[model samples]
Target: MAVFFDAIGQGGSDGHPFYDSQRTEHKHVANGGDIAVLAGISYSVTDLALGPWIIWDSTLGDLTRKVSYGGVDMQPIGVIQWGGTAPGAVDAWTEVFALAGVPAGEAQVVAAVWGGMNSQRALRCQTVSYTGVHSIGTPIIASGVGNSAVTATATATAAGRIVGVFGTRSGMSGYNGSQRFLSNDGVGLLMGDAPGTGSPQGQTVTRQNDGPWAGLVVPLQAADTVATCEPLIVEPTISSRVHRAPRTGGLRRKVFKVPADFQ
Candidate 1:
């Protein structure tokens, strides 16, 4: 098994314009094996006025084939006739989905955020590859109050599994123009190994807040892998400034490989 993490793009700032409308490209490195699963998230403004949104689109090698997840609304605020209105400070929303049989080759994942008049948006994505039969667990959702951190936990039924987590703000009170907006939300993943004599049960795989996306890869031994994993939410420390990651200049790619015999 191999895990790849990339911060596709960030909006509401110079050079990164996801507020009005924008599309960012991320390169996927091929492992010469089948793609077991893929997941992503978008961090956008949580104000009810603009109405946050996020979506993903991908193209196989040579742009011959493509797949996409329809746009997702991240706003958590809602109104009812009897209730009048619900929580008004919601800021962000996240989701994870599975992919069909994607061949072993280079590919590209594109993330887009739009429909908001002057809101900020950011995107992050992950890709996993394995050789044997594997299953993708249902996506878990978690939330927090008056804070940026959030967490979700789930049990893994099979070994050699890759877990993902995405995080964003909710119910932001103030609204600013695209240039001054806060778009620094982040995502992270953690893995817990199966019970053992002396080894610790949980370990932090990867935690990132400076960028748009973060991922963690767990290589499970068919005989000794863990049965549960946790995905944690990381919120931006600085709310006033928009953090800019080092530009990729072009597509960015990363790869991790797990030994075949071990699993």
Candidate 2:
């Protein structure tokens, strides 16, 4: 029977490709392994991609890239890849979030943290064509810029559902000092693969690699490169304690502690 079904393997001995091809796809404790980033890269930034964007940690204090020339707004930590030479590396590791090797170079800050539902089937694209088109990016409009450019006509990437929305401080309010705030609700691209929205303070998400922390992360700056961390993340250790991610992605791996008389 076809050599006993290729000796019980798939397309065996070393040709395995019968279908699905199986591929890949975290940390922060907020994304996996621990998660923390802060060193350099963030002024006009340079090269980075993976999921979610905009992370002000407080800028200068670290985690700078957006808020434009100053950084104050917040949201995004779900980069999951990039940081090969060190720009903060948001990489979640799955072949360096694809593009391969030393994460193929790129990443600086954005390892996702703030928390709540993500993963979107590893950011599938399938060429693009989101069926019913309730939004095409993520229904209900997340906000940033793109508003359109998601093109490609058909192949199917899943087409979203519970997409994110809330920027320009959708709830508004800021002030922490050495940077590092929190707030809430940011990442999206949820059900049926719906909606779309980039950055403009509206919510920011789209440098297009699929949108929403899938790309447009930017930071990379370990002088030039290597040691890119990945095991999920956890190489700095600032943790005053906030880590909360895991509705589908991860983080919130646990580390509360703050009531020692309210610190």
> Candidate 2, residues 1-263: lDDT per residue as tens digits?
00000000010001111211112111011111111121111111111232246331221123222210011122223222222223443322111111101111123222211122222211111100111221111112212222222111111122221222121111222221111222212212211112222221122322322221212212111121236676675455343444444455554555444522231
Model 2 segments beyond 4 Å from truth?
1-57, 64-146, 151-185, 189-263
Number of backbone collisions per candidate: 8, 61
Cα lDDT tens digits for candidate 1, 42-98: 333323224223332221111111224222221111111100122322333343434
The Cα local distance difference test for each model comes to: 0.32, 0.20
The worst-scoring run of ten residues by lDDT in candidate 1 lies at 75-84
**Candidate 2 TM-score, C-alpha based:** 0.15
Give Cα distance to truth, residue 220, candidate 2, Å.
20
